[model samples]
Target: MRLFFPLLLSILIFSCTTKQKDHFEADIIIYGGTSAGITAAVQAKKMGKSVIVVSPDRHLGGLSSGGLGFTDTGNKAVIGGLAREFYHRLYLHYEQDSAWKWQKREEYGNKGQGTPAIDGENRTMWIFEPHAAERVFEDFVKENQLEIHRNEWLDREGGVVKENGEITSFRTLSGKIYRGKVFIDATYEGDLMAAAGVSYHVGREGNSMYDETWNGVQVGVYQHRHYFRDSISAYKIPGDPSSGLLPEISPNPPGKNGDGDKLLQAYNFRMALSRNPDNRVPFAKPANYDPARYELLARVYAAGWNQTFEKYDPIPNLKTDTNNHGPFSTDYIGKNYDYPEASYERRTEIINEHEDYQKGLMYFLSNDPQVPEDVRKEMANYGLAKDEFTDNDNWPHQIYVREARRMIGAYVMTEHDVLGAKAVPQPVGMGSYSLDSHNTQRFVTPGGFVQNEGDIGVHPKQPYSISYGTLVPKKEECSNLLVPVCVSSSHTAFGSIRMEPVFMILGQSAAAAASLAIDEGIAVQDLDYEKLRKVLLEEKQVLEN
Candidate 1:
């Protein structure tokens, strides 16, 4: 009986070995296709590592391809590695006559407004069209033979399995799994990091958490021209709550500043707009459009507001990547509070609500009788770009999920980091954008006027060093994970780190870590900084100075 039991155990062990060998394996698996994801994949290939980028996006580049073809690059000189290479490639594309499908090369000029399109020489471009940016990422992947699995969501629960402080494997909702030596959570949401059991944070921290003045809500602060016009009525028409709070206003209480809460930043679709009648699909009345919903905007207009439709400027091909312009603009604030961690079904509902609100705003301004005639007539001249986002009813499938779950790694970057309080020793890259935060909560002020809090735009004292440690998980946490796009940082710190070009820089650095970890067969946390720094410099990652 003992001999027979031993034989059965041996047979079971052999079967398990066979099953384990068949699981999908790669040197690195990136879990998002934002600009950061694409850069990480390319860097992995440069190091001769087999890689797969499993992206939830049907498209590759995140906002860089979505609608912000106009890149928000603060210090253009600091951009290096794959991020700079991307803009150089964009320049080469534009240098060709055929690349200008709509506008003449001379007509293009410098179109980034205040932001520089070219450096000392006209060899690099900082901004471009949406399709061109996507093409650049696609071209890079094709050249490198990097495998990309589009429209795949990482299963949050049990999707990632770690063994002895290293990520062993991660599975997707489609049942496909990927086993990698090292992994990067390049998604803006930091989903992979969370799934791997790493600690993270969300929403604003108090002023004391990081000694940041702009960490929490600041009501009645009108930084941008996006408030109600005097002619427009109040939330309750100066008295009537029975008339009820405005449509987009939240029912929940607006929490105090310097208080920790789970309020999410406002989100909006980057609309591709055009004036060409042949290509424009005139702003149609959304199916669920309601005129009364825009009562806040109506109040603004009644106050002689006229700053609408000012953001529909030109991109390549005579198209314009229209962003949110002013007060009560396309940004659907206070409606997406539950979205950061909501289920997929709930996320869809929130997205639909935003779409309805934004579309209805456009429709009301263009067609409703309540809008000023000049505003309506002017809005009537614009529509969604017919060629852009054709499959999803002229709407971007990915909403501008501005901020989400940020991993709390070993080092917590504060406003002091950007302010140059302490020099980061393991410098990977640099970010110079202001510690900017959009509105978080809207509330009735002591004076009875509705106002937004948590919109800060304080400039950084200098271009500060961003540490490589910020991108890596702690030694105690999962060691093989490198998070570039959503690296560990405080809320105020993330405000600066969240920029696209900065994300790309971090992506390159993360990939560098992955390659080094593989060569040494060590955890990502313990990689030799000397070797990593040498490789980054050779590849132009800009470690220091």
Candidate 2:
């Protein structure tokens, strides 16, 4: 009788635990808190499907809420559906008088990238503050009642459990397991896609691989103002090889133009600075500040380069969306080659290093006596926005992950799509931005002068359609996974497609396809494109216009 009672107790405990484990089943599982992830969750809810957002980040909206307030929306007419809706919501928020806190509406000039700040006819605002963008994303979560488990880091090594090429369940670092029918990898790094054994590509592809003009290593292509205008010695002491190269300068020579290499473009913090004295916080020097680290920048200034504040793109309320401008600025070139596949600890170290480099650059520009006087005066006028990103000492919580592990899915969007040389089958979204790639490496020329390489900016013919095939993995690899942010595209093509608004559009389309796949009991790749297109158009997604 004692053994019988104990056995019954054990059975009951097992059943209860099983029931608890099955509690989190959802129709769609979004694996990031990026803007794309939030949009996916919202779309899934609209389609009457249960959705959960399992994010590794503490905050939502990735770079959108991070410091990228000046939206890189090229040909905004191509933006439609939830992406346009988001901008409209921003327009509504800015319409209210209360939104203008530090600066008044008329006082702050209404200007944007060759357009008005507010597009009245389109009912959207292209520019905004970071906090306002975060609020809109938070509103989506609240209104949809999304189940988001923030700070839930995935167990990349042994977290995913698959059955017949389908992700049955995934366990987090905290030992919590989540099961879902369809999974969307909306992260910039494509972590879930990699975990699910999806095929992906990193770094630039050779131009010959895709018959692309700008796909590979560009050694002499100086398309932007971010390069040295004159010959600058790479050494700490001018014209001396024994003086050692300055910090961040690669000793290796840049490869042949249009050749392939594994180097990645530079990364920088898109800082939000306030010119308003009432709401400005002085840029604090990073904990590991080293003045000697910026000798290269000092040399650039000494060589008569003075366009430092050219990229302080303005946003609302007298705040500027500061980006990398000159030859030696915010970008930590050639320092993040392993970030796409690095361990968590390694990635954190890289992030901290980037933060230190940028902070040190700001300190050097604003306070150092070596900087040009006019440039120093202009930089001193700006400081971190006090009301922005209040959690991380007024700095952005998410780093700008420009391009990471791009899924090599069923169909890759190459330069032919951007140039209208090839027809895009099963259109999901559109991208119109230029093929813009920042410098990947700073190498010494054969003439013994420092120069930047891999910066290319080629504008597309027009707004081009992004294929649905670019979002799904190969059928043999993972049948149920969808990757929106890290879609299948070459490095140069991805530069055009890797914008926040386009990501939101792709996220909505991915959710729509996921819902259809669940309803039809088919794999994500096998879902009918005609049915998906009908639903997307019905939802006001502009596919062909």
Candidate 3:
């Protein structure tokens, strides 16, 4: 009896020490449940590798499935592989008559007539509802038999374990450890990359840093129609400086043109709203609603900036993927400067504040007496989609983190690459979107008029190749890590590469590279470029033409 008891005690101790529930091992460990993370896991599994997806959020597909149903697809010819497959699946879903729940299929097609969902030659539906996109991403995971651990955030401070400048494993806030031969930082924030001690950059760089035309603080360059057409006062009382600045306007001078600053472009939720009364949930007044917060927008309304409904791009089932539009619209200018490096708690606060600001803006427009009668009555028809984001009160679970920590990897892609001035040495994929950046700050002009700074939208001459070196870290920093979402690129270059389709393309390429490196028993930096390129081509990845 004593011998049996001792054996049982030893077994229990061994079980506790070796087979811990918190420890998970795989061939590749991907952080972030973004579009990139899902594609990466699918690719890794396709290559006969075991992969685990550790997502920071409960829902998958980051911005793609969040609320960005209206895709920012520039020159859709360049999109290939898993990214294209994703859109094709959406097309298949829309083909089913049962897919249209709130509205008739004929009604949606008629409204979305010119949009690619019906007009594209490839038969891929680029426009979709938020829930439809989420379902496709979920299907990818399920079809691949990939392991996903959602709502598991990384412990950025002291959770990473490294060996000789190589990431061995990382722990989450839940004390769960993910050990793998290679790791991919697919999060928009690059939490895993920073935690693993990889070098990265935030904010805009000076024009001289890469001899680019648009990189730094562009105070006067208004490329799109997002700027005010007429003069608007910054003060509460027109032409009275003593009246103080209206809400969301800075009192400081806009920075010099082409000079570097730590300013980040504004961010807001990409709302999936509906006008159908049967399927619409009215925009609620936020718990912290303040009428004064939208005074700038009220002035914008007074100036006849009537483009509020211009960006309510149509999707399936009579829904719209509404985005930021107009001079004083959804973009919360200058409020997210610290978001890339912010702690989880601080980021949550920032996100909540943005949500409240946008919510109140909607409510104010629909109900406030300051808003014009025509605009207010028109806005009253719109509301959040009743069937979308059911778990999160019909609000988008993911915020649009347009740009974040960009890794300064083996190659730093600059405007020279994006503008087709420089040649790609080792092309892994291609991105064709325009170099676009939203306003970074809103300040009073020297003439006492309100203005926005740092919004650039220069179209690239042609589709540009994404370099392989942009995915891997420096050999001395981390040998077995890949950063697909936040690749090595300048602020101006990233403006083009930050699209959801591009992220999915990069994710697939990064996973393929990682899988090859594991098979070759070498660091990701040491993998042969030709071999990786061959595999990517076989998989129908669109590189340089």
Candidate 4:
């Protein structure tokens, strides 16, 4: 009892010491370190605002650094400002011979759709490597001498201290108060905006809400060019019912399209892998890796689905940025529905599940007997690349929060914007990608077979303008906050606008709005677009055609 008392006292003292050490402050506090957050902070600094990026992530670049190295740039012509500059810097980095340390320059080539690199001779854009992208963000901060508070979470309830419609400052969870003239909620989740009394929505809006086809729960849409290799067969692996459904197959009914509710998109680590023995850290079995979890993958193999090893596109240094492959590959569907607005404790559970599932999936594919011999061999050839993200055992720290709490701002972008009906007058940027929503729910069909839905892929007829009003809250609501990551748009429209390039574009535009608000000493909602457009144009931000 005496020894226990002393230990408890020591723990209490250590807790006090730890609590004392975690306080910090900044002038302009940006609440995320995503590609968007980085661009926002860089733009703020460029505008001569005393800025400090308070990132929830330990790593600087969000998806760009996390595993989405394969840049999801839709229209390269539309990408400009610091967003374009980022890819340009990546092009410059790869131009050097030293950049090709592991593989020949010609051998290690880009496969995703994009324009060629610009050499100041021609107008070109859209090319990148993950590490190069992160380095460019780091360089921007270092060059500008900006301050960043990493791993700081915003106070969930009373973080934003707003007075008479203007945010005076915000406090962090650790009691660090950041008093600033203006605050930009650049986070993917929009925590700052939510705390600042700004309105937002989670999950998909009902189709009736927007009079749109793709806004709500799409239960029966199968639009992507994936799935079974041969014919869509009934659930019968040569006489096997007691064997049960595959490991990843969900047994829930895909809710009717247009119904609308929260559903999980598939999440996987965009593995940065290397063939070079030194650089590659083999995808070892995770601590809780269970072969049974990958039982469905084996079922997929038996059903003649063998297109798993197709996503490991090689980057420089013999490294590959591994992405989600085939129908039942990396996407752990039905497992992350509660992750978006979950508490830290709940989020930890979701993250752990994703890690365990992904790691188990890899282990099963590489070693399980049920897996095809060729498939296992091909998967075995790759492992978690060493030398990349050494801190987390090469695992990506950021879970791909595909869609989250979206702000329903003044002018909500809808199918009208993508279909070119209602032209957005206050164009801050443009998006041309197809309205692509990944599979939302998987199910067991009436025919006693597994199926999935909510994977809509309709290419827009033309590039659509994303309105500035979409980024700002309504004039009546909180007027100072700007939501760049999750802007006001219907789920269908958001599908096209939710690319990384678009996020960076919006980030720059949001920062410009914040700066304009400060310059004019007016609410962000009341800032004149004439002046905003002029500044955005000067900054090489493609506000319009």
Candidate 5:
């Protein structure tokens, strides 16, 4: 009977050894085509590692090419490695006369908008147009000859194949399999990290959870010009309680200050607009357009709020990277709470709803009689750029998913790290931006007035080192996976680290460690810090100030 059991065990082991090996294999597999994903792939190739990018979105750069040309670059000096190279390439592209199609380079250069587009001394342009940014990402792929598959959604249901705590392979919705020695979850959603059973948090953590003063729901903390300056009614009719709440105002009681909640901050499309009449697409009314949806906006305008063009930041040519400004502007608050964990189908529905809402808001601003004549006239001057985003009817393909699922990794960065109060061991990058978060919810105040809550911007005293531990999963959880975009950090710290430039920095650092791990045949978490730090410094990554 013992000999019979031994024979059965031998047959089971034999079956496992003969499993199929014919699949798309690489030294490293990246799951998203975000700016971080592209940069990670570039660094992997530079390290002579075979890499593949499995992207859900067709486009390469996420928000970098998706109308956020007015970059949130805090201190440009800290941006090094491939992240700085990207901006330098943009400068090279703009040096050519043909790059400026709508406006002359000379005229655009002297605008003195936010940051100079043509930095002659450093040869790096901080601001650029949407197409210009996309062109640079495409150039990187062509220059590196990296393999990329687009529109390939991960099969979240049993797609991640892990054997004895280490992921061996993963399948996409197309039934294609990808095998790699290491993987990077560079998506804003952190889909791959969650699929591998890694611990993560979606909503804001309680301030007490991390001893952070800026982590949780903030009600009266108004930092930007986005709060209501004048008291406005929250009812459909001026002062009627039974008339019910306005369209976007939430009725639920906002949680206590410094307390945690499952709600996420709002999201919006950073519209790439143009004042050039020859290269503009006028705002069109969307299907099922509702003017009543923007009744709050009209009330704000009636209360003498006319700062619609405050954040229409100028990019190259006559285009502007328009962002959310003033109370009840482009941010569609309290509508995307389920986005972090939503299924593919449900996420699409939420994105479509945001598109419709933004489209309707633009149409109302340009055509509605409720908007003041002066405000409407100024809004009409700017329209969607005709030459940009030509594939999706000139609308941006990527929505600004400001914050999403953050992994609880080997190290969790908090406000202490960002404020330089805590030591950052094994540094990989730097983030200098303020801890900024948009309004999470629009609610009726107890004073019977409409107000927006949850916008806070607290700057760090100086640039701080971002630890390498934030990019890696716990040793016992998933050893081979590295998360750069949705890194391990407290909500307060992530607000500063969530910038695109910082993502590229971490992505390159993640790839460097991945390549070293592959060379030593060790897990990413098990790699020695000195060895990885040596490679990063050699690649010109600024570790500390």
Candidate 6:
């Protein structure tokens, strides 16, 4: 009987070993299925390299399809290469008469980002529906013949196998292993970068750290119309400190103007809403909806704040890409401080909390009796688009991760590079967007009123170049890994560099460098910049103004 039991145990061990022996090999392994990851895979294929994309998301385009249809493109001329091709394809899709299924082509307005939505001369479209954007990304994958494994999450705890400061392979939560010569961490959260023992920063760095302005906590500087115009009491019973501060407002005083803190910028879902009665799904109350949580918004409305519909930016077919607007609106400030480094279970909780809060805000404005009558009437015109995000019950599947773990690599992009005061060596791409950041926290001011802080907007003198060194890690950290989404940058500089188009550009450049490194048998940090620049220019990337 003992001999029989030992033989059974041996059989079980052999079966387990056989199952774990499967490993997929490639020249480059892209760890995200974001827009950047797709672009990187395409570029690597174009360079005659075998590549595979391991995506944690089921969706293709990150935020481009996840509800942020209103693109924040600062200067369109600087957008070239595959990024420009993506917008061009969007233009082609809208040219077809059948594309306008919900609304007539003539009825849809052509206004977006201070330009016409359909630019016939430039052959590009800036605004579109969520479904249309997703179609384009899927088309890219199909046309490129790229291999993508979706819904596969990386094992954050001890999943990365490294040998002498280089990643040999990585295992997923499902026990699937991928071996590659090079890796690109294209995720917005920088999960692969963090797992590979790379140095990164979480919260806002003090202005003194980079020796520039707008890098740290911003208290009194109000750059947009998001703050409260008039002083309003934060208490439940108005002006009585004994009643205690209302929900969502922090009791702690906002620190001095420029002092830094561990707080991060607020994150909210960019909802895709429709005004067309046929396509609109009325905002349903979330399962965990609580009306008392939005008491501060009711008070803001009572104080004559009525900008609820200001940010209902228009897209195609009468759909709107709705974002956070005004004081006490959608952004749940001070609630995401621990999200960057939290466990998967904790991150899911945070995402669910944001979804519930935003969903509840919509219901409160459209039906709550305490809300102002005129504001409620305006909000009643909008609802979730029935044709978008169908698998997730008409809600976006991806949350807007405004900022996350930023790698501190060989080169750190600071405010000097963003403001065009410093020359960037080994230029890979360009960014012209304003240095924009959302509010990080809502706290009581010294005057005993609620105020939102950490919002800053500073524009560059001209389109500035991003360095290639920002994409690769230091020689001592990891030799084969490249990070494009969370590139090395100060808080203020990353604001401008964090645009979607810029991410695509860097992704392509990172793949090009990776291919060159493999062909020359060199580390990513030791690749020839001149050769990379020649290839990037050949691919139509705009490196210099």
Whole-model lDDT per candidate: 0.80, 0.90, 0.90, 0.76, 0.91, 0.90
For model 2, what is the error of residue 336's alpha carbon versus the real structure, in angstroms, after optimal superposition?
0.6
Runs with alpha carbons beyond 4 Å of true place in candidate 2: 1-23
Candidate 1, residues 156-202, lDDT tens digits: the string is 98888888888899888887788988998999778889888888887
What TM-score goes with each of the models? Answer: 0.92, 0.97, 0.97, 0.91, 0.95, 0.96
The TM-score measured for candidate 5 stands at: 0.95
Residue range 1-545, candidate 4, lDDT tens digits: 99999999999999988655654444456889998888988888788777888887878888887777766777777888988888777777877888777778777554556543333443332444566677888998899887888878888877778888878888787787777766777777778887787788877788998889877776556677444343332343523556566556665666776888877465666767677876766667778776766655566678777577677765566777777766676777777777767887797898888888888787887888898888777766677767677798778777777777788898899987887877787999888888877776666666656666677788877778899989988877786778899898888888888898899999999998898888888888889888989989999988655
Predicted structure with the largest lDDT when compared to the true one: 5
Question: 406-497, model 2: which lDDT tens digit per residue?
Answer: 99999999989977888899998899999989999998887678989888899887889999999999999999999999999999889999
Q: What is the lDDT of residue 88 in candidate 4?
A: 77
Better of 1 and 3 by lDDT: 3
Candidate 6: misplaced stretches above 4 Å? 1-21
Error of 5 at 327 (Å): 0.8
Query: What's each prediction's clash count?
Result: 9, 0, 0, 8, 0, 0
How far out, in Å, is residue 83 in model 5?
A: 0.5
**Cα lDDT tens digits for candidate 5, 18-118:** 44432688999999999999999999999999999999999989999999998898888899999999999998998898988888877784433334656
* lDDT score at residue 514, model 4, on the 0-100 scale: 91
Candidate 6 residues 288-402, lDDT tens each?
8889889888888888887788889989998999988888777889889899999989999999989888899899999999998887888788899999999999999999898
Candidate 4 lDDT: 0.76
Q: Return the lDDT, model 5, position 545.
A: 72
Off by over 4 Å in 4: 1-27, 114-127, 228-247
RMSD of 2: 1.6
